[model samples]
Target: MPEETAKQTHFYSVEAPDGSYDLRIEEMLARIESTAAPIYMRLINGKIPEHQDKMDMAQFLAVMVVRTPGSRKDAAEMVGRMIQIRNYATGVHDRAFNSLVHRIEQGEGRQLTEESRTSLRRSLIDPSGYRLELGKEWALQHLTAADKLTPVLFQMRWRTIGAAQGFFITSDDPVVRWVEPKTWHPIYGDHGYLNKTAVVTFPLTPKVMLAMSWEDEGANAFAGRQGVDRLNRLRALQADEYLYAHLDHEVIRRMAVATKGSRPRMTTEGFGPKKFAATTLRRGRANRPS
Candidate 1:
C-alpha cells in the first residue's frame, strides 16, 4: 500500500458534523442489534475457527456479513490454525516479556497509572510522527505475558470482496476518535483446549468494537484517532466499492497467522438434528484455506 494512501485513512471519525453516529456503521449497528441476541453474540466473539482474536481487518467484517442467527447456540463456533512469520523476523509474538517500573503519583480518570503513562508517552507516543504501533520491542518492555504464556498462530480467511482491512465510513466530519483497549478471554465453550486463546481485537471505528472477538483479558492496546489519514480512508472505503474488491489474500492470511492463535474447538449443530464438528466453517464462516 502507498504510504500516502495508508496515512490518509488510518484515522477514523465517530461522529459527523451534524453529530449522529457515522452513517457508514450506523446501519451496520442497527443490523447487529436487529439480528437478535444470538447474531449479536457471534458478531464480536470470534472471527475464525481456531484463532479467536487479534483479529485483522478482514476477519472482523466477515463476521458482520452474518445477518441471521443460526438454529442452535453452538453453531457460532469458528476454527483454524496459522504459521507464516518471515525468516528475517523472530516475530513480535516471540520474545521474553520485559517489566516496566514507573511511579504514577497521580492519574486522570480511566487512564493508565501516571508513571506508566509517562514512560509510554516519552518512549512510544511522544516521538515525532509516531503512531505508537506495537512492535517486538514494545511488546517485550511494555506488554507483559497476556493470558497466553507463549506465541501462537491464528486462523484466517478472506471471503469478503473488498479491501480486506478497511470499510467505508459515512462521516463528512474532518475528525473522529474513540478509545479501544485490548482484552482476552478463555474460549467460552472450548471444553478444555482453548483455555488460553488469543482475544481477537481490531482497529475501532462499536461497529468495529461490536465486531471484536472479545476475550476476558483486561484492555491493553489503546487506539486513538491521531493518525493523519484515519478519516479519509474510512470515507474512501465507503466510496470505493471496486477498490475494496481488490484484496491481498496472501498478506491477510499471513497477518492472521502471525498475529495470534486459535481457540478451543467446539461442536456446532448442523442444518438439522445432527450436530457436526463446530471447528468446521459451517456456521456462516468460510475461507479459501482452513
Candidate 2:
C-alpha cells in the first residue's frame, strides 16, 4: 500500500468463498495501526514507551515480520521445497506413477493406448518441475508463528537508538535478524531467533531505530556516525528490492554500492536469501570496535 513504485497491488489478499480472508486481515491491521500510531508518535518525539506501548509495538513488529513480500516469498519457497521432496521421495515417486498408470488401464478395462500412456507419464513427471503455490494456509501458518515469536521478542531487552548526526534507512524487509558470527554453525544455518546473542533491529524512523538483545546494556541512547552507518549497511544488505528513506542522500547511494548483490533474495524454486553474517555493537556501547 505504501507507494514506492508506480505499480499498485493488494496486500494480504487471497481467494476465499466467504470473503473472510481480506476482511479479517484488513480489520486486524487497521486495529493494530490505530493503537500503534500513538506509540509511534511518542517515539518520534523522543519519549520512552510504557509497558502497554511496548506490548502493542511488539505485536506490530511481529505482524510486520510476517506481512512483507519477502516473508511471503520465503513461505512459498518452503512449500515448493516440501513438494519437491515429496515428488522425489525414494521409490515413492515411481510407485505412485506406476500405480496411476495401472489404475487408468484398469478403469478403462483395457491397456492404455501408447499415446494416452505417454501423456499420462508426462503429467505424472511434470510435478517435479512445478513450484507449489502458497495458499491461504501459509498466511495462517506465518501469523501463528509470529504470535509465538512476539512474547519472546517482548522479553528481550529493548533500547532505542537515535541517529544524532546521520540518519537510518529502512527497506522492504526492514526487520533484520543478525546471528552472532562467533556462535554461528553452518550445520545449524542461522537458526537462532531466541538465542541470547541474536539481535533483532527495526527502524522506527529515519532518526530513530529500535534494537532488542539479551546481552545489551543501554535502554535508550544515540548512535554515533559509525553506528548509524553500520546499521544502515545492514539494512541495505537485508533489503529484498526497495529501500526507503526520507531523503536521497549520498550515504544511501554508498550503501547501495557497498552492499551490491547482497540483498536477500527469495526464489520460486525454493532458493532463499543468502545468509548474512556480521557483528555489530549492541547500542554502540556494550561492544566497542577495536
Question: Which prediction has the highest lDDT against the true structure?
Answer: 2
TM-score of model 1 vs. true structure: 0.18
Lowest summed-lDDT stretch of 10 residues in model 1?
Answer: 79-88
Name the lDDT of candidate 2.
0.68
Model 2: how far residue 197 lies from native, Å = 0.9
Model 1 misplaced regions, further than 4 Å: 1-73, 76-251, 257-263, 267-290
Structural similarity to truth (TM-score) of each candidate: 0.18, 0.77
Query: Scored by CA lDDT, what does every candidate get?
Result: 0.27, 0.68
Best by TM-score: 2
- Give model 2 RMSD, 1 decimal: 10.4
Candidate 2: the clashing residue pairs are none
